[model samples]
Target: MNLADVPKEKLSPMMQQYAATKEKYSDCILFFRLGDFYEMFFEDAILVSRELELTLTGKECGLDERAPMCGVPYHSVDLYLKKLVDRGYKIAICEQMTDPALSKGLVERDVIRIVTPGTLIESSMLDDNANNYICSLYYGTDGSCALCFADLSTGEMSLAVPQGTTDLTVRIMDMLSRYTPAELVLNAQALSLKSVMDFVKVRLQCAVTLRDDACFSLDTGRELICQQFGVDSLELLGIEEDGAGACAVCGMLDYIRETQKRNIARFISIDVVDSAETMGLDLNARRNLELTETIRGKERKGSMLWLLDDARTAMGKRLLKTWMEQPLVQPLKIMARLDAVEAFYKKSVSLMEVRALLDNVYDLERLMTRGLFQKASRKPHRVT
Candidate 1:
């Protein structure tokens, strides 16, 4: 096959399979595995090379004149993957499904794993004390979908049903602050829900999916919630909801069950907090100051593990998770923690001393494993 003979409009079957995988994982940088190296094609090549600092090469695809390609060795995928993820890119890991020697036709390829900022479970890429979150969206029968999220690492769970388009953005922003989920899932037909999710994806550098089967009916949500909690109704949990809320709640539980990490989220708190009531911080500011970057160089010196070392009680650990998850919200809670630190500082403790105290806090997975962990303790010391 020569480059001049390749058709421009339609792709070949192999290329079509690649395109399908790419479309299914548009939000992710699809690491399409061809052989020893994880190959990326076309725009994915451009994006991955630029992000992962790899050499941009080209590969012959039938008659195509060496289509753009870039790749990383399978052994070193984690480092490049972490770099891309740290820079906020979800990666869909496409692997060879069958042994090439055993297969008669083109080597089988399938996406065995999808890595998102929040849904990361790999120990090397995560902190031990942190939580990873996956968000689920369920619209009611009346074109209303509730957003429910859970982070199993720290056992944080929350649900919110946006009333209309006007509330959807704010509701999502609020959830962003509270959960900071790595991935978001929504109903396929929920266009409004999808739009809101897209906005969040752009803002948070996260992954979003539209799954029709995931959205449960209102009665179904209620039934799941009741069954999970072993209660007759939601009223037992002090949850007062119309039919819509019931469905949303149930859809959330169903997703959690399907994910097969039953004990990951221990149901610490559930509330109907309005986004308007919370302080507004854009996604960029939140991610920079809280997650990837430090408020000051001094605080970055220690491990998150060290910070939690002094947390003697379960309540303290839970408080630590809450702070990590919603770093920008609950000002009163953050202030209290700051006040505690200030008291320690007042005892002739040098800033370097505090930095040294935090030096042992190094569990990235544990720190970010749950949705409720916050890094406010390391914020620059406020005088007043």
Candidate 2:
């Protein structure tokens, strides 16, 4: 409910604190920490309760009329967050920052992270064989555009600048189709492009975020790139310091930092993408060919991926899908892949042994990245 809709009564100190925190993240559904429960107040409570089918209640906020409230236990909040995120709602995980036992009055609390469709890291919320990419795009005034895609869970980031193209919208759509990003962030210029915006919203149907133009500052982006990779210059990476690529990459990093509220994921490098290296498959091409899923039920059982996929591990399956999505166009690379497959085919017994070994291997890429986030802890203690 809007502030005008609420009863005119003085709020309790704790409720007042919630109001102040909610103001900062007006777009997100704030999970305000209240002892053992992550409480939702006012509009957040109403929305979440209606969506999740939870019983909406009320709390005394120093007013005769109780404030609307709903809550999910902190230990089991991931389940609730996943439901909301799948429906394209952003969540602000406000945590109790200070100990209540030692506090003089009201315990301090703040948002530790803002979880969006693209920023998911929990194993339960992710698909084992699919990369959950968060894309960032910057469309310059010169009709040139830069695209950045990063899988936060795997710490893999790649930048693509679709230059020398008559229709950059087509190139950008091709890139988006390949990655199938869960979330997209666009600068003011990119968002203003009608065709691209339509493709993103109507076709992709993923969560879209609009970032301030200032966030794509060239100088700041250059510095962020250097600091992130611990490099002196973007020259070594073949990215122009003042180019749209740097701006796109910087916007992505800035958005991630804003949402995560900490340096958890380590982006070791930013790989420059060459579109020509891979076969271009636009949305129509992919859909008609049924490259990954069938056209009817959209299941993998009758698709190209199903026929060739014999991967034993989650990582192998994911890599195979990546290879399927972006078929190598360069002769040398194709030959190298063929040679590796030939070697495995000739050594049948060795291949069997390799598959047996892989059966026991976990998804190490996600495991290592999740470990860095310190999310690998044991089950949280049940709060009484």
Give the winner by TM-score: 2
Off by over 4 Å in 1: 1-13, 137-147, 152-176, 182-242, 246-319, 323-384
- The lowest-lDDT stretch of 10 consecutive residues in candidate 1 is 375-384
Which 10 successive residues of model 2 have the least lDDT summed?
375-384
Q: Top lDDT: which candidate number? A: 2
What value does the lDDT take at residue 70 in candidate 1? 87
Model 1 lDDT on a 0 to 1 scale: 0.61
Cα deviation of 254, candidate 2, in Å: 0.3
Across 1-384, the per-residue lDDT of candidate 2 in tens digits comes to 554365434888888888888889999999998889999988889999999999999998877678899999988999999999999999999998899898999898989999999999888888887889999999988776899999988888999998554587878888899999999998888866788789988989999999998888876678777888888998887788778988898899999999999874478988899888999998888878888899889898899998988898778888899999998999999999999999999999999999888877877777777788788646421111
Model 2, residue 73: C-alpha shift (Å) = 1.3
TM-score of predicted model 1?
0.57
| Model 2 residue 313 lDDT score | 79
**Backbone clashes in each candidate structure, one number apiece?**
41, 0
The models' CA-based lDDT, in order, is 0.61, 0.87
Candidate 2 clashes between residue pairs 3 or more apart in a chain or in different chains: none
